[model samples]
Target: MSSRYQQGLGQDASSLSGPVRQRSKQACLPCRRRKRKCDGNLPCNICKGYGYDCEFDNGAQSANLKRPVPSDGSPQPGGKVTRLTYPQEHPKQPTESPFFPGILEPSKARYVGRYSSIAFPLYVGLEVQATKIPRLHSFAYHTGIRKEPPCAVTCEAAQKIPWNTARSLIEVYTATVHPVFGFLDMDQLYVRCEKHWHGQPQDLVFEAMMSGVIAMASLFSGTLDQDTEMWFILHAKEILEDCVISRFPSLEQIAAWTLRTIYMRCTARPHVTWLSSCTVMHLVEAAGLHHASEFVMQTTGNAAPSPEMFNIVNRVARVATSLHILIAFEYGRSIITLNGQILENLHPTTGAKDLTFQLCSLVAAVPTNLSGDALPMMQELFSSLDMITSVTVDHDFLLLLRADLALGIYRRLRVMDSKFQQGHNDRVIAAGTAALPAARRLASQNRPWWNVIGTVFQFACALLVMDTPTSCERLVETMDTLEMIVDHLNTHLAKEALSTARQLVRASLDKKRRGVESLEHIVRDASPDSTVSDTNDHLPQDTAAMSPSLTSQLPLDLDSLWAMEFQLPL
Candidate 1:
């Protein structure tokens, strides 16, 4: 061997002369384990590289120092070798030998359960402490924290204990306390397996159990608390970020479900107060309907939703729609009346147009009966009208027309009796009439047929409310407006306006059922499906046959007169 190789071998030549020498010359044990090269050092360069507190076995050290010397000055069985060595000191006391009298064989040590007695008291104390802490008490209500109060207590206790004690407690708790809470507290159950026994082959078993528990809870409850909702959202988002988004795309399902449950609960009632409109909108966009549908399909299992479930879901959807409409209307109203900065930042025409279209769509979707909740909803609609009419007419003139017509019908029928209480009819009618002309003027410019029809209807309603025939002249002017609508009703706009006209006509006929024969004749002639005949051409033939004295003395039926005055068609 070269002097360099000889120098590489330690002076304890016998110990260096076997497989140990080969390994040391090639790579030190630490370096070999790390799969790296070793530089000659007391602690090999690899051990230093890895920052281990390197140690040497005393038997190995002694053997290296006792190698035999060769008689002929040639290399002998136990070769003379020089080795790199670290500076050291000799001990003042002799080291006790590991050998024993009986030469006891090495075997696996048996655990004698040293701390078993303390386990019961320790568990009891943990339970007491967990129940006492307010924060932990709140955590118990959390969906995944731990179902069983005691398990959560144990978990809290385990966190504070010494490692060996904690390990013992955890093992005992997992075997005993875990079964009770495993179904209740997912976080505690998961933490038990994840934190206590991590890195062992049993991690997959715990993970599968946790996944099962979570899946079951989601299936049954169909919801979670606010904090749990947030936790799942964040946790699932992280998992997707680390493993799913780019690589394992299928795992995106987890993130998708987390978001869907959060949204569903956020929008559902009782908890509806827990989330705002803006939050729900953002979550819905994030969850994406397709993903939510998939999650529902997968999780909703064999127990089909009961009638109550459907009702609850429908109610939630309706409420959400109402809230959205209310929000949009509030914005539109602010723009019109307050001249709010929100409007200044927006294009008035564009903003109004968008809001009007949305409001109309919402109105169309809102159920007409709405389970007798229509009054509050109508009040909200009318409030919007009051605001919009104060602004530029172009913003919501059509909506105002429709709203006024509906309000008029509502007041006359006493559908919302509370609104007209204490003789408030005159004020209501006056405010409504004052708001109509501007709306009518704007509607006439853009939608003439509707404006004329709506104007005539309002005029008739006004005349019916008037105390004297002096107001009959206003009826003459309303007749002129009706003529324009009649002209279009004979043309193409009939189909579009027919339903509204028919409803108005029906109300009028129902009111005037016992009035003058001429009124009854006019009602019989009005048909939404057929064009109106010229009443002027037929009037001479009809009126000549009636007795003037009888007509003069005829007391009009209040309902029939009201009905005839507003007659259009059903």
Candidate 2:
């Protein structure tokens, strides 16, 4: 029976060892658990079921589990070991990875198409079915359809964008024309400005446009890059030039509006920026209405006449003139010519006389040490005084202009006396003479009390030019006349008269000091060819120190008369 049992075990073992039958019975255990073929052996059925390596024991009982086996099927020196591998199964769609569930969904992995014929993978480790996605083709088509190549939208999730971005964009559009759309966006900005009108836009539109102006100015001033600056300048120049030509009638209003907005921007709380002021100056200067005539023409539709327009024009001109005169004075240049032109153009009907006087004061405030071209300009300015005498309106304003003009002439004469002892040019002297009749006539009228102050100051300046000491006696007589005028003004127009009288008195004192110094200088540097004898000369002792009665017969002091003082009535 034992023999029979041993024989049975041996037969079973022999059957397992047979190649074809063993292959059939010892199929992979992993394959069997997966309901597929499996090879059965010592570790066959159970190892395969657990997805572990199946090993066959030859002679070795203990094996090194740490060292991985080679796959070549060669017996290793220490032990015979073999590596087994199965073919990897791949999902049809690359996005179908179990690691990233739902990644393959059409909504999540929609493709953004490319225009080029070359196909690139949308993602790094995944293969996309490009044939199935229509969005990819649509993206390519749209991108290719753009006339100008589209720039990729950069992520701007950082700082606030500058306000000038819109202006810069418009500038870019204007400079570079796209194939599909040529400055379509820029045209909108242009049209908006062109259509804006008084009362129509109201505050809302004004605010919007003002914002745009600030932005454009910032862009043009090169707060941006060079390309942006170039673009803005080119487009801005074109727009402004066009506005100048086509919108000539509205130019003044527009300019005024722009200027007003800039002014507000400059003074706004917190302030805009440093470069904004420069931009404002640039815009104002570029408008080309700095001159009075241009200002009048621009503000008023008719260049012939318009009192209201003239008044506005006068104000604007005065402001601009004052600004320029301030600049010239600060830089040590002559402002006399500018003052002269402003005075000559003062309109009787438009109340510009005060403006004229203000500008004259501004000119006078400049240092008188200027020479050469500045001196000549002052001389020319003195010559234009003849026009003030003929003005027939606004006597108070005229008086102010005359007083200021007289003061200016006196200051110039003082400078000339100190520098050029040879005396002023014949033409300027003649012009002064021609202006005297008008001054005398205006002075004759009952005018503002300040007129007397101007008159007395004028007489004082003229007295210095007298060739004889007797003229000083005559000046004392004139002082009596001035005192009477002052008394009359103090009684009737005291309030308005004091300030002007005080100014005149100060000027007279200055003139006295200047005259004494000038006389001393003349005596010290007396040239043989000079007409008047040196102050040391007693003027021919036999001639007698003439009394006021004797000197009163002499001609009036025309060179020092304040003509405009009488031109503007009280």
Candidate 3:
């Protein structure tokens, strides 16, 4: 009896209270926010069903269950008290954007659009497929943003496009974009175009690839008709994106993505385009294009390489490398590689001597702080690029590379002779001045084929206009030129870039009028290369001197708007 009593004393008194208790799962964040019941599965059925963020409240203390109070109104020795109650969350009536579901209030809707189909799947896995979707478009059924719209290119429309019209788009691509960046063999693509013109069943991947190429050609053709050019790109995007989700992709898939990536960069979102480019890089590596030498040896150890296989291998390596470099440079950063260095032989070349050397120069010019004059490098680059003046010989990728080169040099010009701070030296200003003719020439040549390309144009124009102490006339002319090209474009991005340019122009004009040394407000207030530009945008300080369109009325009654925005549900 004594031994048993001693043993009982040694055991934990808390454990003696009862058997181990079953833990009640904490409610998911969405369920808690919406006041819905949570089933507590990994996603919590409520969040999984509605497709909301399902993170848990880490701050809420875990509720430990204990033995219930004795039936006789005597509190047990180790009774648990549920102390993790939050203040009765007077549930706020969650307001949604009246105009666009994925969008916020009036101000922010312009850049990111109403909803991000990209953000919806991001919380879920990247490759998670919606197996039970009813609609043809998977995003509609899964994320439930909008109804599945009809395909842009219907069978009827496809039949209606004359073989001649289709042939013309192909011709445009061949004449303008090819010879420099040749992904598809012109002979084979021509044969396919001929076959499609006869109304035969082409491979779906092939059709998508062809659609993208034609769409790209149309944009550069300066035929601003939305129907003929932009429609083809949009239709092809749908088909290609669907192919990415539903089908086993091939080299055609790579080409299809390159088209989409380029279209997105020009027309809409730059960052999304960047991400897509990275995905293309990964896909290229996956397809063994990186090790084509090994691939040839593995398949045909004792035999000479077929011309067909060698050409395919060469094009893929070149396209993948150039696209990766250009995309990285576009976003204003050098490549951040974690793995060991790439093989000396493995690094892809741009194929053209002028482009290849300039590409190397751009890569070498990455260290942002150089004490010496950069004018020689800039001159050398321009001189090198000058060899190919004829647009007839210039490929589309080379054109983009040229603009990108201008963008890099323009950025370098801004950083000239100034320590860390963004200041314009007289020499730099002179360089900026010299760049104006080149910038204008480039804009005229490209005619705003891509979205960010317009921004590049805007940056150049603004720099030139701002560099002058008294060039209001030039600024007006610049605005007119920008409007003539960008204003005609259909995408919201064009307007966004134009607006940025105008703000800088207006701000610079204001600064000149006031005779201020600092261009701080213009730099601080402008949406230069932001992922999302905000609506709480400031008017130029000297707004009274500015145009009526440049100045708008702020709300006279802030309280009312505040009250409406800050209300909570009972």
Instruction: State the local distance difference test value for candidate 1.
Output: 0.33
> Candidates ranked by lDDT, best first?
3, 2, 1
Off by over 4 Å in 2: 1-311, 314-316, 319-382, 385-397, 417-455, 465-477, 485-570
Indicate the residue-level lDDT of 482 in model 1.
50
**Predicted candidate 3 versus true structure: per-residue lDDT over 394-482, tens digit per residue:** 23344444444444544654455313213322323333233344445555666344522443454446455447543343455546656
Best-performing candidate as measured by TM-score: 3
RMSD of each: 32.1, 37.1, 27.1
Candidate 3 residues lying further than 4 Å off, grouped into runs, are 1-160, 222-231, 242-249, 292-304, 307-309, 332-403, 409-447, 451-499, 512-570
TM-score of each: 0.23, 0.25, 0.47
Alpha-carbon lDDT, every model:
0.33, 0.35, 0.46
What would the per-residue lDDT of candidate 1 be over residues 1-570, giving only the tens digit for each residue? 011112222233233222232223333455445444444334443343223455445554344334332111111111111111211122121122222101000010001111234223322343354432221012223568544322111112223223453334335434332231121222444455455444332222233233323322332243335454344334433432342132211112222332333233323332332233433233222222111111111100111223222222222232233333333332222111110111111111232233423333333332222224666665654553344333332333334444443344444345444443323344334444554454445434433322335544555555554523543444455444555455544644434444444455466656666567778788788887565454333344555455564345344345654555343458
How does candidate 1 fare on TM-score?
Answer: 0.23
TM-score of 3: 0.47
Q: List candidate 1 segments past 4 Å from native.
A: 1-399, 402-413, 416-424, 427-474, 488-570
Which 10-residue window in model 2 sums to the lowest lDDT?
294-303
Per-candidate clashes, comma-separated: 18, 20, 5
